[model samples]
Target chain A: MMKNSLMRNVPENYNPYVSSDDYKSKKRVLIDKKATNSTVEYLESYSDLFDKLNITDGMTLSFHHHLRNGDFVFNAVCQEIKNRGLKNMKLAPSSIFPNNQCLVELIESGAVTDIYTDYANGPVAECISKGKLKGEFLMHTHGGRPMVIESGAIKIDVAILGVPTVDKKGNGTGKIGKSACGSLGYAESDVTYAKKVVFVTDNLVDTLDDYQLDGKYCDYVLKVDAIGDPNGIVSGTTKITKDPVGLKIARMTAKLLDEFGVIKDGVSMQTGAGGTSLAVAHYVKNIMQERGIKGSFASGGITGYFTDMLEEGLFEELYDVQCFDLKAVQSTLKNTTHHVMSGSRYANCFDDNVVDKLDFVILGATEIDTSFNVNVTTDSHGKIMGGSGGHSDTAHGANITVITTNLIKSHMPIIKESVTTVTTPGADVDVLVTERGIAINPLRTDLIEKVKDSKLPIVTIEKLLETAHEITGVPQKIERSKEAVGYVVYRDGTVIDTIYKID
Target chain B: MKRGTAGTLESNDAMIMVKESDGLKITITSIVYDFFHEQIENVIRETLKEEGLTNVEVICNDKGALDYTIKARLLTAISRMEEEK
Candidate 1:
């Protein structure tokens, strides 16, 4: 009774209705007739929904990463599968955070053989780098993720949506609960396409309308006492290092902003949520305040810091794909100037996107070589570590991409003779900042000449590398296994680089 | 620099009247913003329960304390209160 053709001819502006052309189109696809009725099913617990759904091998399961490191749902569900002795189920998460270390155990148990995610960090990335998972790993941008789901390229059998707040009707919202994480945009596509959608929440309300996510799409609602740690949701918003060394780097970056003449009013900028990047924002804020300048917009993973800047009239608008703090959530909910953008709109290189309009973007790097090739993933040991996220897209799109970091970390020089893996090409990076000095990429001679007389210390890329080498000596090259554990795909879905297992 | 100089400084009620740290003043002034907002009471109750304390005062000169900062401030306030006799 389920129409297979309904998914094929979905209109440009399709609304969820049974009789509309869109509904008829969806009804034509009768793969499973029993699932057509959108009725509410009260599940006693998550385990009950898992049992009722009959999750089997080769079935695709999905999860969202709104909770970041504080999320316990993914690991909890995967643990249940491991306990049930399930195998070969593809794990398609919106993103994976560091706290989901239990996924390493699930991978070893053979319950999850394949993974498709926008980001992966910590032990899971390490495990994947070691070629631990049996199947291929695919990385998609936030925008591409929804596109893939909508196109039916990656069919999701069951989507386990972790709700910070949910009603009996399975409607959920992340903006108004104890674990409120803001917009449910990432899970919207999954709920629409998945054969069965399950709502897992720690906080359940008396009515469905209280939930922010549309309840019409959900099939079952299961409640738990505590869903995720509120602290972890905004864990990335810590203060950047105020060390004199970091301040010097930040000053150099700010000077670079001045020299590029991109420090004028109405310029748009984006920066990572790292300590050093946040430091750059702090410095930029001071310059803006001093110069009496206001920016046009700020974008990317928005934090309360950025929202406050917007609220304080520092920026005219904020384009947020995902909010990093509760202040951001409150701002997005209350302020009209704060806009929510899809991942594709945020950083999909295949599409004409907003990142292309950014005047400057301050990024963090684990290592950079003289070639200007950057590596945000892996370490000197070639161990699988970080994630690509929006690094490459933003680097390529931003008018001036400045990579700010200390010359050395933990006695290891960050400017290495050669980077372990190239996440962003050197051609895209405009400047590199060290505590000692700033290095302009050779391609930006105009920038080089413009800053010639600036008081900020300017040095050659080679000199910065030498400074790092002087302190740490030469680093030992890591021996890598021939087997590819995971691949870092550019925003266009091309294999930019691959990570191998460290022996 | 007597302990009792900054108010009646109890064991856990210590206060240091030092100069403000150098940085942006990310101030957050939250006073149950929407009184009739759904689950407003529940959020406050849950926040207190999650923080694991009874009574405390939080004075924050926010350089932009995000949601996490607000929660952290409350948590710090509660923990400071719990440490007292």
Candidate 2:
């Protein structure tokens, strides 16, 4: 066994991100001069663990959303912390979900005074949008999250994570047991960097067949009855969108990708779990299967569709950071080609990231303007709905970034005078594919020149905006509020845009 | 007076609930209420006026449906509310 940066006795086959690239040159990561906790202390309860750690105010406690909307650890721990009347504790979860609605109470009670997450929505988001979160509610990208964590920008006092299965030595994996939500990718850095790390598990086995996280970092283990509801841990199954307008937008996006030679052999791609984005993958899959073209790797939050491709040999491998559905979780258990990459390895800026190897990525937009600035961070009314999970990271890394959406929905046009908030800049955005037409960013003249001769309904941004107005009619402009709820940070760690609270 | 219902809650489709009342009263719940609530109310007013319908209550449950879909649903609901039973 060889020692890694965290001084874990990594198995011979264990692969770590030894070096990182900054686009031009590769730099080596620092090695551990000292060792971390090599023994795991098994605790039975969160309160006991909290007391053992001396739970205090103004502590940055963290968790991961691998359990998605079904997670129980975050809520249970928050309730305990609230029960203890702890004040001013900062939540540093990787992302927040509806199940994490318990955070709303914590926020209101002043138990959780600050929040630092990559994406969020539902009650906690609504509370944050209403300007109820007393402390700074800052948003970061998935990649930027790890960068800041390692840089000690966001100091985490304790990282209490849920692990599905644990070995006697405290090594954990999210791939087995009842609440197996695969790919403990998001929690990897948390376990490695936090001052104290705890793994709460429901299933204890003699040994793990494979592991994503090392045991050296784990200082405590709390065995519980369950970590989360299995049914709610991940999606039942993801299906391609059958929405007519969505299909049209997706078809246009696929055609544009094909016309631009993005569907060729050895191509690497990324797509979200959105129906329209899935439709684009469906269309592109048919083309790849028809031509018998094999690709390299598909990365990011993987779905069953991409796993099917891996099985069919359409792609060589899948670099999954998080599993979006149950099928993906199963694939991680059985498929040898399915590999898990840490969040930093996935898209951290100033590091060699998977997105840098991405040829194209299909993403959605809550709103887009003629300038190609895309906003997934808020609704049309400027309420906090989502932040750049990997939107800007993939956009910045991919050779081509495509935004797919209907020109108008419910009489509201997507292409407007300007976006409600800028989650990704126009420089990174390459093409906008709507059912009405497709618009290429003028910055990407190379793409424009290539697709100019194609039969795709390529149009200028202004024409698309005009068509949107014709269908949706001119909408009344809502006044932007003076108070800012929060700010969106780009992948490069810059404040791309500030979100205004909806009055 | 009998009640009539038409349309659906699907995206780009609005559900219309119509019934007999003392005077025309239209209440709308639209996803785009912030931007197009006034427009949706105007569409209902114009459609009911053109149909020469009076003493009725119209409720529109909108899910980002377009103006034409809303109008069609309202018209169908009006006919249903007036049909012989």
- Candidate 1 chain A has its poorest 10 consecutive residues by lDDT at A1-10
Q: Write the per-residue lDDT of candidate 2 for residues A120-186, one digit (tens) a residue.
A: 9888898999988887777889987887777676778899999999987789998888999999888
Candidate 2 pairs with clashing backbones: A21-A352, A410-B64, B12-B65
* Structural RMSD, model 1: 17.6
Query: lDDT of model 2 at residue A225?
Result: 94
Query: Model 1, DockQ value?
Result: 0.01
Writing each residue's lDDT as its tens digit, candidate 1 over A1-503 gives 12122111112222211211121133212122124335667778667877899887788999988888888788888888877888898989988878988889878878889898877788787888777888867665565576566656678999998888887666777777788787665776677778888888888777854444577788887777777888887553446676887777787788679777988899899988776787788888988999899999999988888988998899999988777777887887788898876665676544457788999999989999887878886776556666567787788788899999888764457897667776677878889988877888999898888888888878888999888666544554544576666665544444556667775
TM-score of every candidate relative to the true structure: 0.74, 0.91
Worst 10 residues of 2 chain A by lDDT: A14-23
Q: Chain A of candidate 2: what's the TM-score?
A: 0.93
Lowest lDDT sum, 10 consecutive residues, model 1 chain B, at B1-10
